[model samples]
Target chain A: MMSRKVRKYFSFTAFVLPAFLFYFSLSLLPTMQGLFYSFTNWHFMNPKYGFVGLQNFINIFTKDRYFVMALKNTFKLVAALVILQPLIALLLALMIEACAKWLQKIFRTVIFVPYMISTIVGTFMWSFVFRQVFTQIGSSIPLLGFLNQSWLSNVDLAFWSIIIVSLWHGTPLLMVIFLAGLAGVPVQLKEAAVIDGAKPSQVFWHIKLPLIFYSLTICMFLTIKDAFKSYEIVYALTGGGPGWATQVMTLNIFEEAFSGNYMFGYASAKAVVFLLIVLVFTVAQLLLMKRREVEL
Target chain B: MTRRITPLYVLNILLLTLLALIFLFPILIGFLNSFKSFQEIFLSTLSLPKSWSLDNYITVFQRIKLLRSTGNTAIVSALAIAGIVLFGAMAGYKLSRTRTKYSTVIFLLFISSMLVPFHAIMIPLYQMASKLQLKGHLPGLSVLYIGLGVSLSIFMFHGFTKSISREMEEAASIDGSSEFGTFFRIILPLLRPAMGTIIVQMFIWTWNDYLLPVLMLLDMRQFTIVLSVNTLFGEYGNQWNLILPALIMAVIPVIIIYIFFQRYIMQGVLEGAIKG
Candidate 1:
């Protein structure tokens, strides 16, 4: 007979093995292998490569101006999103919360409908608006003529166009999160504050916000992570144009590895850098936010 | 409270109404203009179409092979969800129950990789896919989805499994039920709420994902709806008529699912975000 300890171990293996195999092969192993490839001069065309020892990393920093620019653009986008999305979502959630019960459901559904659409399709739809509808509106309406600006083509405008679309696509989720947070804010506490002569703003500041701090952290975390990983919106809307003005790091990595040069090793190095940046920011954010999270 | 209309309330409602209109603007325009002829759309972009027409829809339906691509997407999503739910539940349950050092190490190994961005893994993953002859294959793609997706699902499952009592499992074991049978019968049924959340989360993610499929799948015959729509956009850059309808069609399925499962979808989002 098998020993009890052996049986326990066997059962554990039997249960976890399938998930581990797939996760290791596809997610874990590839990540480690990608890190290993970053130091080499691997290309898709040639099977042979030699260890270049941080050449790719050096190039990304010192030589590859595009990668640096992409990194800057990603940070810009993240900074914008980190500020705007949660604030707007919170404002909207507050408004919706103040509304009558039935109106809340209707408004919530309409707002969140955008989040249901695939990013590619949603971006394409926005492109159509920017290209055709805006131009038409500009020609007809004298006051709205500025709407006719080439949104996806002009370098300056293209960045804002991506920001606008990302906000549009991303805010609904945060809004819903804020709404959920709002639901957890005890009505009695707000009423008590009001009875104690606290104004609406005062009540919100003192009572509601503190209660929803956990949700705020989650929303901020999601927005930051998503902004760093922003791809499809930029890919579909701008294609990292006009002249790489809107290229985020993911797009840069993709173009480096797949689209043109097929520089797998170099791209892997950028990916590693990208991973490290994301990890640092996410870890720092979580650590910082977790401290402030209040228990009910 | 006074049953009277106040200026501030009026202002709030008007502002919210305006915001709602803005939120719905893109979808409204996409749907309305999908019926318009190109000339009509160009002439009055904001106005309703002169007459509702199905011409664009018909043309795009034929050009993009919308039905075939939708079928491929459904198959991919179903297979991936099946694998994710099954494997995630098994592993999460086992890991949550077992408190040994090995289990803790394995659990940590899975959880620590949760923040590793997909972009970091894409290149080598692509290489590995090619090497395994799994690139450009749908089943292979589904397996990859399972791989990429299971970590978070397992995390969710692990957290969820801790809430249920362990007495039932012990009783089942004592009643001569095998471990696998106990999980499948006793434990799995009790995990319905989590299962629902996982199914919704995985379905939307797999169904809506664009980047991985673009990298992995090559043939036009195997394109998902998003891939096919992207191709149509590239092929007909200036043809807004075709593009708009295709976008609408591509969006319709998810919208339908969302309408049906709005409550569950929202709950899933909140639960996943909070727990994750």
Candidate 2:
């Protein structure tokens, strides 16, 4: 029986081996090699790499202006995503649920559609809309001229532009998540709360929010992680330009490794730090949220 | 069930319709502009063209070689999705059923990887690709995408497979099915909905992917639709005619897929969002 069990285990391993091959080759092998390369100044275009212990990290911390700014910007973006996106999504989900049945799917479909488009393409389309259409619309309204600024060109407004785009693409799905969580909130519980003289807001704050915390936490994790690595949209829209004002970390790393010069090792160190930051947040979220999944 | 459509419900429907328009209007703008001549596209930025013309499409087809790029994208995306579904389900099922330290760690690793930004490793991955002589090869690019996408699909599949019954697999085994046979017979068939969900999502992601394809496929012949269309931005002068037509070509697949499989896509997204 024991030998048979071992044979069964081998069979199962065979079943998983194909995915493992792809995963290990592309994801693990490259990343592990990247960590190795970080210890050496392995320039991609050149062969003159030699071991340099903590120099790359030391240089990044000491000399890189963009690195420090990237960290601060990333954390700021993360804070905004963690706090605002899910809360707004939850509120929208509530409003949509109180809506008519026929209209709900339409709203859900519309909201999620942007999420499906190329983030780069979508941001570009929004650029045309932002630079031209929104300006045209904003200027027409009296005293709201503050909104009419050159959004993509402005250092101040560009980050907010990226944030708004992120929210627009992201919020719909979170809204849907909240809607699904709403489905799990027992009707009997809602009715009981109503009978016990709970107002709608009170019931929602006390009941629906607690039940939906799992979805909220997942949304928060995704939002923050995505915010950490926000590159493609910012890359496409600003090209990290109008004076590096909207330049995020990933873009900084990309330019460092590619266009500026081939500092592959330094880029890898930056990447490893990024990986660590993402790992810390992910682990923290899983620990915080997994306990609250409430297996039911 | 017997209630009439109230004023509030009417207002909600109107609001949703307006919002859906906002979602749809960009693609619609691209589509409309594609039909218009270059001059008209500029003159009337947002309006119906008087008549449809295929000149822009023909020009782009001749120039960018749309059919071949579409073919390459289709082949790569199909293979990648097939790999993800077949391999992701197997791995997900195994991890979900077993509770060993190693398997649990692997599962966590997969989950946490979703958090890690791809740009971090992109430079070195590109180097490795060059070294292995895998750059510009369709199969090589497909493999890279499969690796990148597996984490999310497997995370999803793992959650979905846990809801499958032990009794069903046991029944298959009792009837002379081996463990492999039982998994294939009982478990795989039961996972069609999830398989559909993951495949469509993978299709969208892999189809719209820009950065990897841009870096890898250095030749014009191997350009995916996105790579082809995005080159518009770099062209000396923005030929709205060529660019708009190319954008249409890139998006049509997704729109077609959306129309047919919106229900499945919505369900899949909702499952991903709420469950995991």
- Which pairs of residues have clashing backbones in candidate 2? none
What shift in Å separates residue B270 of candidate 2 from its native position after superposition?
Answer: 2.2
Q: For model 1, how does the per-residue alpha-carbon lDDT over A138-257 read when each residue is reduced to its tens digit?
A: 888999999978888898889889988999999999999999999988878877888899998998888999999999999999999999999999999999998989999999999999
TM-score of 2: 0.90
Q: Pick the TM-score winner.
A: 1
Instruction: Give residue B209's error in model 1 in angstroms.
Output: 0.7
Q: What TM-score would every model get versus the actual structure?
A: 0.98, 0.90
Q: lDDT of all the models against the reference?
A: 0.91, 0.77
The DockQ score of candidate 2 comes to 0.52
Model 2 off-target regions past 4 Å?
A1-6, A136-148, A289-296, B1-17, B32-54, B95-112, B166-179, B236-241
Worst ten-residue run, lDDT, model 1 chain B? B1-10
